[model samples]
Target: MPTPGFPPSTLDAGGGPIWISELASDDPNHAVHVVRDLEPADALEALGAKPRLFRPCELPRSKPDKWTSLPAAALGIEPGEVPPG
Candidate 1:
């Protein structure tokens, strides 16, 4: 029951979205964006090959790579050690 040309895919019931990323830290000054595949078919088609029988550690949900909050100065609150101007 396998297709000849198209890659194989299955319905994953207990996994998270699969992201494609390099194993490198993103530059602080120049940030990078990551894309994830939510559908198994899309992932398999992109890969052009079938995945392993049992995938391990399907990766936990991602957290913010960097702090996106406004700077302390913008918040009108300065640090304790710094002199108040």
Candidate 2:
């Protein structure tokens, strides 16, 4: 079964710690996962919603979003430094 906007990677057995990801979404660089598991009206409720039915975060923003902003320089390696064998 194909989930509308959610990717297959979000599918899990359910009933445990909640997790959200957008690595498999289209335009993943701009994609994000929002987990809303509580309803303000009823704090005790489980939101009674399905994650697969949730929409993918596609808001327009500046270039190089968090997911695609990982640079090698952040690893404390010099520009021309190669990995030790």
Candidate 3:
């Protein structure tokens, strides 16, 4: 059963509310890895970025790597493998 304030299992097997952010990774072959319970400042440090403007929004939970790679795919860049989170 799905919990209140959480995404359904069909959308996200983890069955938790999904969050969106501007994530950054040092490794080109891997997804950005940041602890879920990070403070906003900590998250910014992880991205090696200074404060920037962003509007928070939510979307249906889905395999993000698939869609996030669309632009690369259009440019004929092979999609990288995304390990199960």
Q: Best-fitting candidate, measured by lDDT?
A: 3
How well is each residue in 1-85 modelled by candidate 2, as lDDT tens digits?
4343455554544422123222233243453334455443343235454544443234232324433322222343345567342
- lDDT for every model? 0.34, 0.37, 0.43
lDDT of 1 at 77: 34
List ranges where model 1 is wrong by over 4 Å. 1-22, 26-37, 52-85
Q: Which segments of candidate 2 are over 4 A away from where they belong?
A: 1-71
Model 1 agreement with the true structure over 36-61: per-residue lDDT tens digits:
54565456546564464323233333
Q: Which candidate, 2 or 3, has the higher lDDT? A: 3
After superposition, candidate 3 runs with Cα above 4 Å error: 1-30, 61-85
Highest TM-score, which number? 3
Candidate 3 clashes between residue pairs 3 or more apart in a chain or in different chains: none
Two-way TM-score contest, 1 vs 3, winner = 3
lDDT tens digits by residue: candidate 3, 1-85: 6364444533333543333221122124546444557786678667885555322334333333554543343343345654222
Q: In terms of TM-score, how similar is model 1 to the real structure?
A: 0.21
